[model samples]
Target: MPVFSCADAIGGGTEPNGSEVVAVRVGQHDGYDRLVIEFNGPIPAYSVTGRSGTSFTTSPKGQTVTLGGTNGVLIVMHSIVNWTSYLGPYAFEPNFPVLREARQIENFEGYQQWALGIQGSPCLRVTTLTSPSRLVVDMAATR
Candidate 1:
């Protein structure tokens, strides 16, 4: 099992329109995954989107984030002891390096990790990792 905390990265106040944008840290634990979102105030509803690559839709409840593309990956981390046993089998070798590095960050402790990479002329790379109850998303812009 892993431990998760949302005290460090939660920034900005709740969106005045009953929404907020939070950069969550996700991780894995005990065969499950988790996510931790930080905010200055209560966040009723929010959605997260990538700058490029694949485009997806997420409901206002912030519970589901759907993704599409050739190499798109999505992980949901919402608890402090969730593991990543739900990620179905696929070719996950090439992405190990980026995932390992993001997992080493202190803010991403005990969170589940999910990643997605679109091959060929990609504008940016989005890597999401989670522990027991946190999520860490890394977006690398290409030039």
Candidate 2:
């Protein structure tokens, strides 16, 4: 059995000067829903913070972005560049049991942001993976 914490999850110290977010993937698991951010280079410094509402404002632009759910999580990656390389969907409503939606908030000025809409307040577990360099976030299923 794996242990997950509701506390903020943070990792990586590398500066993604040449890296780009290649894709974003999500999956439904037995006890959690997983969100993955694929990168073309080394994974960048990132943080995951849980929030109370689904409404979030975009960085640098101040545009309001709302998602479908009672609670949400914010994902931020630093030192990232070249957002044009990511051709994947900017927003998706997976409608998973816990993870309801995933959307891109911003990709400007060496910073990247994403939001995950969740059904209820849930714990989060974040991990950095190699080989292809990816960041994984798991949200525990709400009862």
Candidate 3:
């Protein structure tokens, strides 16, 4: 393992007013970094993409955020928002080997954006799960 591992990228069109991001969690897997987002409503639609260095995630309302990282990844959920009403806390940077940080950038108009900073060439896989509607992101430790 190169310190990170991933299978494939995941992308889907997300709709507004579906769910909200309640919390973020990260754990070290066998060969990948696991990042999960807890949801309070239905599982939202989302898109994921890899980035280089600092990048921006602009909302529909012209809101943009510059996230930090060398080969960062972005996950934009259309059906969720980082609402204050949710009773969960977020861990911005767990300082994992592959996943350096998870930065919650913006929460506006039912849209939520998060950044996953990587140290090397990023390998990633995105997923959705039940039992409380969660979004999962996995990054590879090696090629």
Instruction: State candidate 3's TM-score.
Output: 0.76
- Residue-wise C-alpha lDDT for candidate 3, range 50-116, written one tens digit per residue: 7677566555455555544568787876755555455544436666778877776656666677777
Candidate 1, residues 88-138, lDDT tens digits: the string is 232233333222211111112223233444332222222222332112333
The model with the greater lDDT, 1 or 2, is: 2
What is candidate 3's CA lDDT for residue 143? 73
Candidate ranking under lDDT, highest first, comes to: 2, 3, 1
Q: Could you tell me how far off, in angstroms, the CA of residue 134 lies in candidate 3 after the best superposition?
A: 1.1
- Candidate 1 local Cα displacement, residue 79, angstroms: 24
Model 2, span 1-143: residue lDDT tens: 34778788878766555788988999999989999998888888889999999999987889998898889999999988776667778888999988999999888778889999999885888888888999999998954
Structure candidate 3, residue pairs in collision: 2-141, 3-141, 4-140, 4-141, 4-142, 5-140, 5-141, 6-140
Off by over 4 Å in 1: 1-23, 47-143
lDDT of each: 0.30, 0.87, 0.68
**lDDT, residue 16, candidate 3:** 56
Q: Which ten residues in a row have the lowest lDDT in candidate 2?
A: 10-19
